[model samples]
Target: MAKPGVRPLTGWLFVAPCALVFAVFTLWPMLFNGWLAFQDYFIAERVAAWNDFANFVTLYKSATFRLSITNSLLMLLTVPIIQAGALGLALLVHRKLPGIAFFRATFYLPVVITVSIAAIVWRYVFHYDGMLNWLLTAIGVFEPGHGPQWLDQHVPALIAVMLFAFWKNVGYYMVLYLVGLAAIPRELTEAAVLDGAGPRARFIHITLPMLAPVIVLCTLLSTIAALKTFQEVLTLTGGSGETVTALYFVYNMAFSGFNFGAAGAAALLFTLVCLAVALVQVRVMGRHNPFRRPA
Candidate 1:
């Protein structure tokens, strides 16, 4: 016979399989990576030895790692501009105006395209004989044969990457803003209008405040995406340019150098920095989140 209080245990029986899979795949790998960070694993002959804090010391002292961190932080600065572009598009299409649906669909088309594919498409555009250079030359913005080399330098490559990132992600963020805008009760805007509020005033005092939670969420997501940039850099610059981001460093160490131990250490440290940023997002925005109950 089944025990009297067996129902709770039965539910656990159903959950047990998923829990086991998670432990095996997620938890085990994390623990293993943590251990690897402390080991002195050499690619030569696949030798391994115990070494505590050696990776950390080398990583912290390396100038390349420092430069990578700087580049990552610099890239992160573009998130707000991306949000602004997204917000503008969302506002334009959130209403039931004529052709609004078409505009919304057009803006969102880029989001559905794969990043690698889009980057490849853009790579041609950024080429020396690309359309951008040709257009600039025609417009007298540059000499016919001496246009700027976008992928040849650090600043230009990072700028190209930022522009691509903004173009790629803005539409996705716009859809999120549209959802938040839809959830906003119409009555609030109507009341503000009846009270003689101007368009700018209503937006400043009402719409912006109402979109706070969504904006914060987008900021967090975009910040994470920006800081962990890799594939875009790989496809856009062929990983040969002067731009080497933190994730690119981790990738290079693991694959090119075959220093998995140092890579794991760098990955762990990068995760903690990202964790701190996420914690700040929650701490600062959790109370203002519309989903939260009033205290």
Candidate 2:
């Protein structure tokens, strides 16, 4: 008989197919990207003799690459804004207010909407002569005939895309916070209250500590998502802004310019940067995880 807590040969056999698929699809591509970083591999020409990091050198020398890095870094700053807003929404909805379920559903509704649809809807809302400018005009902020170029300009386009992304994703994060809040032990809060602790004190000391795991998970996930921001930027700005991100640059390099090797190198570098950020986050916050004892 198989030893308890150990997998049998049959179980290993069962997992072999999944392991093979993962290795082929995910592992091989990653390895290939690393290889491509060293040489020039064109679409029609295919892979060439290794150039010893020439592609990487070229990537670093490009002005577009620098702009892409700055754009990605700036976009990442929105994560905390989103997480804090979501947490506030969670705290509000987690209360025993009337129609709480309805409110919770309303909060999550945006996440269910397709990104394409959201982008299109936002397109109209932020149009040069659209409802936003109309409201601004009505309030005398601007003349009826005047409106900001929401998508035509670089900065405004970036801001508009970020705003839409935040609105669409905040609900999903709010739901995650709600789940975390619900799982927190009610007795702990009651005990704090009994000890003459008010809401603010209890939240600061007890609630946040208990919710540390959830916060870490959300932070890491949001960081990755922000790093990989492509669809919204593509749909909203079409990679035309001065704020084109790293992924968009990769997309353009590979598809538009047909420079497969350089794109692959850029992608590999982006992956390394993302991994570094994730490691830094873990180093900073990993000790606070509830599942691990604090040193």
Candidate 3:
């Protein structure tokens, strides 16, 4: 056996490796990036000069940056769409039915696929003469060879990105809801049924209340993912001004434009926006938290 003090030390020893990696890879880089936001970083000469907030000023005045922000905000509309669709899917799959496991696996397949690969496949679907238009024509929604340019126009391109986001992420949220539904005590639902509560009544009263935490969690996650959307836009439009997002703007600034300082500022601003949204969500959703202790 070990001494009482030795056990605590050993626990810390086990945690030290992971803690060190987080400090080196995550903490240090974030700190450095924050520092870079305030300085004009010269890549070749390894020099950095204080820029006196010029980068942020420039970003504020930039039409492209403003458009990117608008597109990112527009992506927020998909959060509800994804969440509702996922909940519907989870409810559909939660029943005892033949071949339910296969259906669950099939729905979740998209979550495991590489995002870049999936976006590339979607690029083809959004192409002017792609399957989407072909189907639309077949359905008589569009005349032959007269479909709107999906990837060229701003509104359509943004809509395409939103569609891709929904298809790629709904299954993941569905799994989350499945787990939440599983954890709900069947006793409550069964008792409600015995009390003459119909399916809709039980779901509205018991099920929704119990699943509040999970709803909050999925909503928060979906919101963050929508705000940080980058890969879909990158692959679909290649940072075309129409579908460029804030994160993609940061990428273009750092890698393509070689303006690390501006990129750093944009990144910091975006991070603060994400943090603000998360805080607001927690505050608003925490009110519905069934497990919270009374004040």
**Per-candidate total of colliding backbone pairs:** 0, 0, 0
Query: Which has the greatest TM-score?
Result: 3
- Give the lDDT of residue 183 in candidate 2: 96
> Global lDDT for candidate 1?
0.87
Residues 37-105 of candidate 3 have per-residue lDDT tens digits of 999999999999999899999899988888988888899999999999999999999999999999999
Against the unseen true structure, what C-alpha lDDT does each candidate score? 0.87, 0.86, 0.91
Evaluate model 2: give its TM-score.
Answer: 0.90
Q: What value of lDDT does candidate 2 attain over all alpha carbons?
A: 0.86
Model 3, C-alpha of 272: deviation from truth (Å): 1.7
The TM-score-based order of candidates, best leading, equals 3, 2, 1
Q: Estimate each model's TM-score.
A: 0.88, 0.90, 0.92
lDDT of 1 at 114: 92
What value does the lDDT take at residue 161 in candidate 2? 75
